[model samples]
Target: MTSRASRSGRWMERLNGEIEWHPSQAVTTMTDQAHSVASKLEQLLKAVANNPSLERQLKMATTASAICEVASSAGIELRPADVVKHYANRLLSASDEVSVQNFDLCSWDAGELLWAMKQWT
Candidate 1:
């Protein structure tokens, strides 16, 4: 075999090993995950809105991971990616006037956050 083909085969081997889901299941799995994350986001937002202690803890959280820790302690489900995606969606819908890089938020994964944003550009 050609050297390039040998390297390509090895790369494919590693890729297949690292990925668990079948190609047919990828979309359904991702959709389910998205719904689960959205549910957690809604739950966390409502909890924060209704509970002053939870709100305070969230506000005091220094990072998205910290916020997740706080929420988890309060029996709320939150993930760092969920926090990143939440802000991504907010910014995507926000007016262009609000793109200030002010330290108002905690975590950032803007480049990889939203697949839908690719449609906007």
Candidate 2:
């Protein structure tokens, strides 16, 4: 899992409070709007979980835009950037060192969101 760990190392470092934000770099904070989007994301995922057809559609979605379309059809407002920030907030809000270590790698991979969603099934 070296590649997985390496790919997610930035989140790991941020969890440990090791990252110092520079003005030029983008930082994701848990703003109210972001939280709202994250909640919408949760709503979309839950809808998919409860609907077999939706789950299948979501599983077949190959890109963030496709996923958003699926979510939109479910009446949930979500975006790719929202998905990215969702994981960032999750990593940033880790309650303990162990939880940080146990952070789900698949959840952090932007390209593997469909895979991650399936894993939750």
Candidate 3:
């Protein structure tokens, strides 16, 4: 009778040990899944940050190609050149025009200025 009781106690201890291990295994599996999901989300965010909108990129490329074509037709070679002096000269001319017009400078908001500048571009 004593041996039978001891054997039964050992069997019960083994079963309890397996039951404890099962929950830990489940917890580890869940942790791994969570980590995978977090890593994918981070990668998606980085991709979005690095890539610009396709429509905008297409528009810019088209405009640049058209400019090159027009330049080629006009017998003008298109080369990258510093246009800072040209831009500064234009800005100075615009400032002179704005100064000549005695309008309230405070009323010229940024949005209005940007809209006016877009015409030159």
34 in model 2: Cα distance from truth in Å? 2.7
Model 1 residue runs over 4 Å out of place are 1-21, 85-121
Summarize candidate 2's per-residue lDDT along 16-101 as a digit string, tens digits: 58547653443444466677887887898899989998899999987678888899989987788777666666777777774567
- Candidate with more favorable, higher TM-score: 1 or 3: 1
**What is the alpha-carbon lDDT of model 1 when measured against the actual structure?**
0.76
Indicate the worst ten consecutive residues by lDDT in candidate 2.
21-30
In order of appearance, the predictions have TM-scores of: 0.51, 0.51, 0.32
RMSD of each: 10.4, 15.7, 22.8
lDDT tens digits by residue: candidate 1, 31-83:
67767877887787787888898889888887789889877966877789877
- lDDT-best of 1 and 3: 1
Which of the predicted structures, 2 or 3, would earn the higher lDDT when compared with the native? 2
- What would the per-residue lDDT of candidate 3 be over residues 18-59, giving only the tens digit for each residue? 784666788787567555544543443444355565223433
